[model samples]
Target: MTRSIDTLLVANRGEIACRVMRTAKSLGLTTVAVHSAVDANARHAREADIKINLGGAKPAESYLLADKIIAAAKAAGAQAIHPGYGFLSENASFAQAIADAGLIFLGPPASAIIAMGSKSAAKALMETAGVPLVPGYHGDNQDYETFREAAQRIGYPVLLKATAGGGGKGMKVVEKEADLKQALESAQREAQSSFGDPKMLVEKYVLKPRHVEIQIFADEHGNCIYLNERDCSIQRRHQKVVEEAPAPGLTLELRQAMGESAVRAAQAIGYVGAGTVEFLLDARGEFFFMEMNTRLQVEHPVTELITGQDLVAWQIRIARGEKLPLTQDQVPLNGHAIEVRLYAEDPDNDFLPATGTLDLYREASAGEGRRIDSGIEQGDSISPFYDPMISKLIAWGSNREEARQRLLAMLADTQIAGVRTNLAFLSRILAHPAFAKAELDTGFIERHTEQLFVKPSTQSAHFWKLAAAAWALSEPKTTRQDDPNSPWANNCGLRIAQPRRFLLHLACGEEQQKITLREADLAGVCLTNDRLILEQHGQRTSHSAIRQGNTLYLELDGQIHSISAVDSIALAEAAAHPQGGLTAPMNGSIVRVLVSPEQQVAEGDVLVVLEAMKMEHSIRAPHAGTVQAIFCSEGEMVSDGMVLVEITGDAA
Candidate 1:
């Protein structure tokens, strides 16, 4: 039996919600967007035909409330609810609820999701179905002795994974016996917070393995197919950051073998719509099933680019009881495609998530085989309620090298300011020799740390010189004829007068500098549309500049630098205080305060642990000092740069 869907409600936020709405609209189906309180004016809401207010900003008060989402869909007259990846996408109860309400769930059946709900249970099912399982203990016991015994049996370097974990939460790699207890406790606490499950699985860790996944789809009828594979080996903290289709060095025979196994895994569960079966390819090319994601994946765009098929559209059609459109052989994989996730996080500061207004955001030119899938625009804030992934940059070409080349240019051409991002980090990874050579593994990013996390030289004299000139020339009367005091307004745009020098103050991160600029140093000083253009030594340069309050952002030379403008008065006031404060690196909840008031601590000693976007970051003592005050407490929500603890240097 088949039914037509006239409207779809996307039960998610940010990029995925926006991504789903695009396809739904093109199909002539009305799209409904459900947003939290914070996303009242979000891009997804603007793109959707109908918007529903879910009232609260946090997931608990908004997106995670399945009842509220169903009510919104019903009120908007949506025939289906599409859980885009995160919130309730893989939730078995949510799927059942949708079915109970007689609304279409644009994903696998509830029974299938339950089949693969727990990692340990999923492994048991895979083994029974003749699928290759990674050697590990999959049991119901969670005692300390049980984990210890299993780790010893599996040998050293085992992985403790939360049975209900995804997106790398509650997963840790322990290299030796000494670290087992601490790792276990940390994984348990994280798993409890993330998935509400304390159960875990101990797996024989695969060293130097490649993380690969097969995209599978099924229809209401008895038909299914695999859309080849994607290599997601490049990661940080077990979360995938870059993904590509048609893994670089995989042979066709192996691809087919793995694809069929993935099909079997899907068919065994009676799965429908889009799903992913993940596996780990070891050094010897042998593969073992890891787990199955019974929902749409975050990296589904790369698979779509290579196959030239719209996976989201397919999911919609499948929910309408349409049969699989293509057989396994008819599924075409035209070329190679690569996708990099752009996050609002600082790579240098342990990749802590950032929260702030986008101040200035400009994408590279697309439609030339470069695709940008984003959920943000200029001036939108990256709120603390959800994931910090702002956009995805994807490119396709006839081969791997061509795709890689396009990515390098696309990333370099893109610009983002205000909040700190991992753009420079991504560029460094793409330019690395190993990444270019396609010698990839799950540990590749950590293995070549020095080559990938390049530190920038922010104190260059030439950069300061340019900043000073740009700042002074940015004055309105500098180029207008109405003001007679303009230095270049009357001298035929030439610096024929005495060189007038003025100090231009700027600050970025922890360092601040004031550079003196004279009119004689600038060749071309023009401010047009908030951009500064000039020539130096026959080379032209361009920068997109925006001044918001005391902060100034300059996007030039393939990078965005954020600086705070300072004046003599403000500088003097800051110097008078002569005190340094420790601030929260991102929007997060304070897990615990490790030090008491007036507690003496040494440099590098851990003071507080903050959790944001599903990762823990330690706030350490910057120098040996006494803890003068504590501003935050356990379980308190804090915004970015909110001072958490104050420290005063010990009297020398």
Candidate 2:
């Protein structure tokens, strides 16, 4: 049946939603966007030809509501629904529902999704298909005794994985027998909480394994092709942080073997559209099947850059019952491509997700070999209801070095503010020599932990000067009349000379500085020929500056600096009190509160568990103290630095 897909509805958000719509529109298909209440003004929502309101922001109320999504698609007269990964992308019932609703589901079949839905089931199927399987227990017994026996048989140093989970959730490593019980319990709890499936599979943990995956595409015409492999070894908390196509260290023979195995896995289940067959490459050059993602991956950009074929376009075409664009021999695997996920996370703070409005967002030129796939704009909000990824920055080069260098330059040039980002942290990782040499593993981030998580230093002198100039320029004509106590007030002039001295307070990260500028510097701080020339401190520095509201983005050297004017006194006062207070580290929802008023708590006791951007963060007591007050309760949304609990004094 060859049905034309005229109207396509995308049931996702963030970068992926925008990414899918671009291809759908390119194919001349009308794009319909579904947005939650909180995401009504999101970039993805605004980018579509037609928009449907899902009524709520949380996934449960919006993206995860299968019935609502189908209804929206039907209401918009969409011919097909494209589940852009995550949410209900892999839900067998959702696929069946879409099919039953007489709308095409731009993904694998419901049967294929079911075959690979659970880790245990998928491994069994792989073993049956004559593919290499890792040494593990993939049985039906979920009892404690059965698990204990499997762990004992598998020996020490094993991994407990949730059968129906991904994204490092519901996973744990037990190195010793004594820790097996607790590890299993924790893994099962997390698994049940995440996937509603506590069933587990025990596997022998590879000492040092490279996380490699092959991108596979299939058509409804019984044809499949492997588009080569991606090395997603650079990870944090078991989730891929950086990915590159054509995994660096593999020889031609091993690559062929891996690619063949991936095709076999895909063909066995009759996979349609884009899918990834993940494998763990051990130090001995041997590979073992890990799992198969039944949907398009988050790091699919690298694969597309290398193959020169749009995976999203292929998905749409296949959903419309079109044949494969090319055979295996026709697939081009040229050039090296790399992608880094730009997340709104604080690397120094245990990589906790940060949420807030993007006070200033500026991206580098994304053309030709450089690209930034993002759904955020200057004023977009990174809410706590979904993934914290701001974008995926992809760079392509003729060779590995060229691609690495291009990504490094782009990472430095990317400018984002309002919330703490992993920008500086990503720059350090790419600059590391180990990464440059392609020596990577799943533990790459942990191996170079000391160097990669360095604290950000103060902004350059030129940036501060630019910030001062921008603040001065933002002052209104009625600045003196707006507030009599204004620093720039006419009556507050200590020196009324030709070059008036103005003191401006600014805060950059953790450091605050008071920069004094003269009237001559302000007069000469002019934008001429698209360049901001500032003359201050007897030094002249000229750079490109983009001013938006109180924020000033400066391009100094090759790096981008986002600077904003802030009150130094207000920041100092916040830092003044550091005792007996529990403040939310980032904007998040209070998942659990463990303390009460007047309750004596021990030092290091967990007082709250905050859920932000799908990651849980524990708030611990700084010292043993008596709880004086509890200001916030569980399920309540709290902003960054909002005090949740207050203790009077240290416990006796």
Candidate 3:
């Protein structure tokens, strides 16, 4: 079965695709890229040796179409196909199809994928294989009453998850019986939309547990070995936000126990190639299997950094009938590595995905300890059609503290503009004393919300002054050569025999402030290399600043603040429509509009649900009001800030 692969096709898009291709090319294999029409000019497509147009932007239309992907592989003369960890990555039928087409599938056998494909089925199999499992119901009975009864039996707090998917989609936590029905409905809807499967399972929600997962690899020779573990406890909404390798504070005995258990789970299903078995480790060192990801994980780079191995290269070799690269005893845990996902999301806005052009994408310099894995470049757009992850910043150091401090510095040096991101939120987490001390768990974000969710509005008066100066200095000015004393030449309110003064209105997020700038205050302000330098009060300071039209994106203390210079007329108009309606928080399609015009609703009632980046976000009623009108219909695409509903507030 040692078949040679001279060409490899990546049947995916974005960073994972690009990352896989980089390895394939390094191994002298011709790399092929399959892309949708929207990704025709994407970084992955442009970097591949051969590119195929898959013809649609949506996952269903392009990436998930197994037949189209197979055809693309055949047409591109590819000998093997690599499904890069997303759409179709864990699809058993897709894997079987690739094998039937006489091309190598760079993943586990289709049988292994099917065995672990369903959460309910996987738990049953794991139970038979002697693997530890959390107490929950993983049965075929998905009825509401069944789940309600299960919840009552398991406890008040339980987790409802889509049986067929991961990545936090179709997952909900029901704290009590009152919240179970609606939570189940929403979870089912999201499950059906995201995974094409509405099956669900209820599990006892473990409290204060750390999410530790073991990375394992196997080959055709029935050889399998675990590659240590990753601590992925820092999360929001059940999705991992930060990951580090060689989980802190794990004893050798526990590591061996978990690693051996993970290998057993994989071998039970005859797993091959790269895989990860996730577990929830309680404080007492007991771990239970959560699930298994049959494809390469998003946090695989952290493992690679610590192990000094190319997992993609190993996957290729494994498919060619190679043996495991390293035995469990030989797998070296070198230095420590930590990674943070840089998402195009507003951390202050419930981490809702944001979409826009990456107007000024500049990553920190990658050297010995700093690494940046990204598929986006400057001017690239983060569309609503896919995941809004801009990049991942990873740092490796001699120890855990060294890695943490290095990652903190990396977060500081990185910059992203045009779209809201979690950059500042990441920096705060790294700098937090608890995190530095390795106090990690799934509820870390919730526990430290007061400190992590610091508002940009806490900026000082001097910060606002600098912002105003940058805006004023960036103003477009024209001068007449014939008249050196033209008033227009000095646009900063230059006047005859008077102190130059101007009223500036700046808005950051929902907070707006008016700062009066006088000539004396701005006399020492100058712009250089996209930085604003201030020489005021006999002190000098500089800030990274840029003016894109009337919006000033200033970097103060490693956080990007988007300040819009609003005119009085615009401000008056905004105040005029204080209660006009609810606007879309981000660009997406209206999945459901629950309220009809003229219908009365209470405050906090769910009204409109929008689907963006393959996730659904609900827009609720802001106050008790009557729905005056709804401007959007189901399936209609909407932009951020576009008014979707108009309501007339009820008078007390």
Candidate 4:
């Protein structure tokens, strides 16, 4: 029953689509890509042999449109559509539609997806299959009272998760009974927005649990095997940030047990293709089934690296009615591999998703156990229409230490501009003592927050010198083309009878500083190919620096520092607006406007709710004040830093 796949269509975007295309093209299969309007010029679309523009930016308007995707696949002559995780990957209806259209869905059957699609349903199925599960309510009752009673029965500090959701959306940890109502409502709203389902289930919020998941592959012939396990304990907002294969401190017996359980879970649903069974392992080695991801996991790379197998290729083979690549004992546990997700976000500001051009995007050189899987290039725009993930940096080594060090070096070699990123935060996490000692759990980030979160401080003296040197050595841009003789035409401050000196006002983070740059200070400095070399007082230092307009992005001490030159007008505006103005942190649609014109509000009160990157963010009051004006309405799309509400602070 094996059918040849002459052409393949990837019905998703970003790294996963690009990743699948790489393998498909290598195997001599013509690849087709379907993109939204915003992704017309994206890397995934550009790499494919043929591309179809689905029209629109939002997921619901584009990638999630299953019929449009199937039609595009047919029009492109693709025999199979690979829903590469996210979008319609785990969607049972989308899978059924592809099958109904007589096209192969490079994933599990619709029936399998349905069995494990909902967390509540999956928990019940796992319970029936003799898989250990945390005590909770998984009933059909969607009333608030039902959830309330369930939470009470489950005791305080319960976890509420969307029945039809993954990736932390529609999930919340209610610490007490008093906060259950609001938490439930917020979770339901997020669930409805992300998965179109407001149904939720409650479970005990396990303390200090390690998130370990097994990678299982099944074929149409009923052959099933577990590739290995990945520890995705390092997370933020319930989304995995760092993942690694051969979970630290996992014994051979424990691994075998988990792998067997995962295989059973997959076989129980008559699953085929790649899937993941997530488990929460406690301190005493007790494990409980969390849920099953019916599609490939985002952290699949770690398993591939450890097992030396292409899970995507296995999926394609399985869809073509082939048997499993390896048996239970044939799965290899080679070395260790680690992956960290690089995102366009502000870690200092609650990891809020950032959007803008990738002004100066650069990646660490791949090879020698270092791999960078990304779908973005320099000068690309990170739109609000999709995920803010820039790339996933993966490193493999002979052991965990080697892998961790390689990843740290990779982070140091990477540089990004235009938007804030978590590169520095990631570097600190890898360098942290606790992480080095394998003190990992779901609360790893919070448990070691003080060490992982670096506070914003003033730039160092050497940093100022480097910034001045880079600026002085770089060619200045023309300000006025019409009048070459005008004083404004000369960007460099050139006086008629004095040494050249420039007055620079720099803004870095929240600290602003003024520096006087003299030509003599840059006498022994040079900038060639964006590499800055400075020899000051017989001390030589080299750094990578990129100058874009009035902004200078310099990599100093393994951290990227974005410093902008501010003019007098910018300074005046900053001084005038000393009171914290409520602005959209990122490009997103306004979900709720909680305040009105001239409304009095207390400090820390939520002013507006904004939905971006599939998560909700609150624009809270900086201080007690009176809302002078409301400039934004609910459901309005706003750009980053766009002022939504203006408030006059009380006398301060």
Candidate 5:
């Protein structure tokens, strides 16, 4: 029953599509790429053997249209289709459609997809299969009143989740009865938009639980095996930021239990291809089934690194009806691996999604045990129409400590220009004490918000010196053979008795560093009595100077320092209104205005809800204050730090 698929049509876009195409090409398969109008120039499209235009910019008009994908497959003469991780990958109807069209679908059967597609149905099936599950209501009752009553019985602090979606969409954490109604409505709306299903389920919110998941694979022969586990507790707004294989604090007993559960769950549905079984593990070694992602996960790279296996290759072989190549005992995991998601976001501003052209893009070299999976290139524009993920940086080491150290080193050398990113924020988080010790949970980011987003203190002396140097360097030089009117000659009366003076102004974080420059040359520049040398090597320049006009650009230690010149009058005005605060983190639509003018609120109070990247984020009050003015209303679009609201404190 082994059928060979010589050609593959990749039914997706971005990094995952490019990733799968690499594996397909390695296997000597002719790859066909399908793309929307906006994605015609994308990486995957250029790398594929053949390309088909899906004909629209919006996802629904192109990528999400099943008929369009099916037609493109037929036109391209592709014998098989590989839905890479999203779009139609988990859609049972799409899978069935491919089969009906007489094309091979490289995934699980339609029956298995249906069995685990719905959250409610999946929970019921797991319960019957003797799998541990969180206490919640997954019944058919869809009435709001019934859900409210169930919430009351489940006690306060419950999680309302959309049963048909993943990726943290349609999820709400209701702390008390007062917020239940609003939470439910919001969750349903998000669910409908994200998964085309509004039906949701209520579950007891597990406090401080670590999010872990097991990767499992199965073939048509009814044999399934688990590829160990991954710890994904470090997150922001329920989305995983960092993930590692062979979970940091897992014991052998717990690992075995979770692995066994994952295998049984996959076997229960007769799953084929690759899938992930997520679990929520409490502090006391108790774990509950979260949900099954019936497609290749975003964090699969780390699993592959430690397992020394190519998961994409396995998926292809399994789809070809190949029997399991290794027994359960033959499968082994070695060393440790960690993966960090590099996203186009401003971590300082509530981790808001950002979009812009990639002016400078360079990934860390994959030397030794490093791996980088990137979708963008220099000059590529990061569009707002899709996810804002830039790339995934993965590193493998002999142990978790070594992996952590290597990843930190890799992040430090990583650089991206032209748009705000979370590079600095990620570095801060990785250096945190709690994270170092593996003391992580979903709320880890929220708890350390201040430390993570702290602005660097300005260095006045360094700024002054650098500015003076730049001003001196910009001064006109005189040539002995030049006339006074010559362009190379100094026009003003040159006095050999006194040194020339230039005022320098440098601004750093709301303060100005002013200095006077006298002379500057290849030897050094003088700021009053202090002198510093200048060095130029290759692309890097180093020098020190005084502050000048509102901008100063200097080079130091092989790095360029650009500081804007500050206006003294403007600085005074800004300092006078130091308490006029609280701004939006990024450009997004204001979905909900939680507070009104003249309302008294305490620090950390919910102020507004901003929606970006198909996710909702709550903007809170930074300090206790009386709302002085409201600048935005629900449904209004806003830019970063637009001052959505102004708060006045008693001290101010």
Candidate 6:
């Protein structure tokens, strides 16, 4: 029986809410959006047919307040509620409350949520169900010494994870005994903040295990099926950056084993609707159950693309007491799909979350096998109160190679201006040789951090091309009406002669790219032996500039390039320090300083520890150097790229 739900209330914000609204609308359901004061004008809120204000700016005052959400649902006259992925999605109590209020919760049952909500309890249940699990301590004792001893017994390099939470928050990798206490404290704090539970569990860290998860959907009639697996091994700071369905290197035999395990896990909990069973696969092909998310995952779209299924629709069907429409053997997965998370973050600066209004956010066309799920608009403000992800770019292709190429092209065409982002960094990683071969693991980012965030080479001639374009755009010009013989009169009525030369400074690290441009034409703009062609079409502009912010204003390729003049001296100074020493990565307090003035250290040695975003990051020595000075002390707050230590070493 396909019961129609007239109105559904979305109890979350950002991308996931917008994503849910699309599915709800397709099902002929009128959507209601609940938002906090900060999000009253958000994209999701504005798009919904009905909107309700929760009357507060903070999470607790609005989204996290169960009563407030319930009232908003009732006020909007919604018959069902979609929690999206975060906030209260996994809150079993909230789920139960929604059911009690006679409103359908578009997720698994309350019992299923509670069963898999606690990491320790879920591991125990999985073990009982004969699912392979990592060997570690998931006991009830909360003694620090006991955990420390247990970690040592499990061996060094263990992972401390929040037993009551999901996401990357409240997680830490302890490589040695010296860092155990700090890691534990940090994890506990983060766990408390994220899940209101500070208890954590320790597990042996799998050095090179692939992070793969199985997407499963179950109906009320006890029918459950796995939608296939996704490889989420490409991560930084324990958070997934890129995810792909039909894991590149997985074998059919292994996939069967993992898929069966995932099904069994879901069945064990009597789960309904959409959920995911995550696992860690070792190089030896042995797999261990990580955890079960009893709610929709952020990476579900990848599974949908590969399986040709509407997962959200399936969830709605199950909520309405529908039986499974398909069987295990009947389900099919075709082609390879990859999704990359575009965030407002600085990868070179330790992937710190950035906040600002999106001045320009444009995604590639849907054709050519590209799909984009985004929540931000051109003027949307990325607030510091929530996750910094701006959008998820997904691409599908006939095969892995085609998918990879299409994804790269999509990224190239996609542009986000105004705030710093990980666009270039993501592109570099996708194009990396290791990534192309699908040699992936949780440590992939850490192992290739240097190559991944390498400073742009100054010796490249493209640097001069960008400088020339910047100079040309900055030069003052007169219309063609001013002079009939002007070169600008040839095509459009734009004319310029002896345009004033403008200076530009581009800094990569310690190196500086300085140049001046006076004129620009179809052939190319000249700058100290460098020539750059200015392709113009309407307001769009494209140039061979190597650095960001090189092009100013021009009409090229149906896009507008508005160039702003930057201080040449500041650019020179920035360029002078091409390798700008060791700096703090995010907005965090300096927990410790490992070096003092004139202290010599080798590459990769710990220089400073910064605690930010509820995680601890150790800033290491870039190369062999003598520490010239230290700019901060313990407990001092620092922003992204704030120089914490200066090292004198090889210039190159």
Q: Lowest summed-lDDT stretch of 10 residues in model 2?
A: 490-499
All candidates: TM-score: 0.93, 0.88, 0.93, 0.94, 0.81, 0.81
Which pairs of residues have clashing backbones in candidate 1? none
| lDDT string, candidate 5, 1-652, tens digits | 8887998999988889889999999999999999988788988898999999998765566888889898988998898999887567878998999999998888888888888877888999999998889989998887789889999999979999988767777898899988988789888877775666789999999888999999989998888888899999988757789999989889988998999999999898888888899999989999999898888999999999988998989988988889777677888789999999888987777677887777666677668878888887877877655677888888899998888888887786565655667766777777788888888787888888888876656665655665556555544455445475664376234667875566767565446666765544223433331123444453443243323334343434222244665677987997897744667766667888989899999988889987766667788887788998988999787776788888887543
In candidate 5, which residue ranges exceed 4 Å CA deviation? Answer: 455-610, 617-652
Winner on lDDT (2 vs 6): 2
Off by over 4 Å in 4: 476-503, 509-511, 535-540, 569-580
Taking the tens digit of each residue's C-alpha lDDT, what string does model 1 give over 478-589? Answer: 4566777766574335544556666677776667786777657765666677677876678877777766556666765556777767666977997898755798888888
Clash statistics: count for each candidate: 0, 0, 0, 0, 14, 22
Instruction: State residue 546's C-alpha deviation in candidate 3, in Å.
Output: 2.8
Give the number of the best model, judged by lDDT: 3
The best-first sequence of candidates by lDDT reads 3, 4, 1, 2, 5, 6
Please report, as a residue range, the 10-residue window in candidate 6 with the lowest summed lDDT. 551-560
Q: Would you list the C-alpha lDDT of every candidate in the order shown?
A: 0.85, 0.84, 0.89, 0.88, 0.79, 0.79
User: Which segments of candidate 2 are over 4 A away from where they belong?
Assistant: 140-149, 152-156, 174-198, 456-500, 518-547, 552-580, 596-600, 648-652
Which parts of model 1 have CA positions greater than 4 angstroms off?
456-458, 478-503, 524-552, 555-557, 578-581, 595-605, 622-629, 646-652
lDDT digits (tens) for residues 231-349 of candidate 6: 99999878899999899878999999999988988888788888888999988888999998888998888888888888888887788888877899988788999999998887877
lDDT of 6 at 82: 89
| Residue 78 displacement in candidate 1 (angstroms) | 1.1
Error of 4 at 61 (Å): 0.9
lDDT of 4: 0.88
Evaluation by TM-score, superior candidate among 1 and 4? 4
What is candidate 5's CA lDDT for residue 599? 98
